[model samples]
Target: MSDAREPVTGIEVPINLKYEFTAGAALARFLSSIREGRIVGQRCPGCSSVYVPPRGSCSRCGIATEEEVEVSDRGVIESFTIVHIPLPGNPVKPPFIAANILLDGTDMACLHLVSEVPTERVVVGMRVQAVWKPREEWGYTFENIAWFKPVEGA
Candidate 1:
């Protein structure tokens, strides 16, 4: 009997996934607020922590966050990195700054793009503000704010 056999090789399987995502009440409210050029978050009654893009409950206290807090587009960079590699579907070019921004009046930091300044100059605690797209381009998504930039003299 022949003992030799063909070597096993991997097969490429293309996946096509389609589904509907219903952003529940908490997120729906957040989306609506952003659509109107406002940033709103829910305050946790238990721990008094505010969550932007508000999760329905508080991670620390495990309680419902009901109080809506309006936060400024301005924030401080808690941390950041200068991305030098390009992503497959990301529109933003490489060599850009991506940051974890602690928006004013919120306890948690949100991820966002930083621009309009030299990458070498971006630092922790640097104040930045949202640079929104034209009003006509506003939508129910965070993309409405094109990116964040350093706030002069801040």
Candidate 2:
């Protein structure tokens, strides 16, 4: 006896709600950090780069970041680009400012929202600080801090 096979045909399927890796240590740290009103990052002693939201290991050095670096609220704006398109899931008012900030004391730069100042006022060397949101609305997301604001001095 032999078996027959079906001819080649392309069919599209949709993905519905499904279960997944819900929570773990990383998530717990996120919750804890928000409640304490601080931005924390993990660092790899090998490469000397700190990561936001903390990571178990370093991507470049291939080692664990056992040290937790308390990043300064202020950082220098390394680079940025103006965004003219508005897409779904973006809560910011259109024509907002987004940039890569080389945070103080860390060798890495992270992308985040820039605000509290006009878009035209922003520059590459601009110094900005982390502006935290109210304690009540501190969720598990990075939005705990509303945006980066221009620092008063240094």
On lDDT, the leading prediction is: 1
Each model's Cα RMSD? 3.5, 7.3
Query: What is the lDDT, from 0 to 100, of the residue 57 in candidate 1?
Result: 94
Model 1 segments more than 4 A misplaced: 1-17
Highest TM-score: give the candidate number.
1
Q: Write the per-residue lDDT of candidate 2 for residues 1-154, one digit (tens) a residue.
A: 6558776587878566767756456546755775677767778888788876665677899987767767776798998877879966677867878889888887778888898788888899999998988889887767887889899865
Q: In candidate 2, which residue pairs get closer than 3 Å at backbone N, Cα or C atoms, i.e. clash?
A: none
TM-score of each: 0.89, 0.77
Candidate 2: global Cα-lDDT? 0.78
* True lDDT of residue 8, candidate 1: 66
Clashes of each: 0, 0
Candidate 1's error at 146, in angstroms?
0.5
| Overall local distance difference test of candidate 1 | 0.93
Distance from true location, Cα of 147 in model 1, Å = 0.5
| Ten-residue stretch with the least lDDT total in model 2 | 22-31
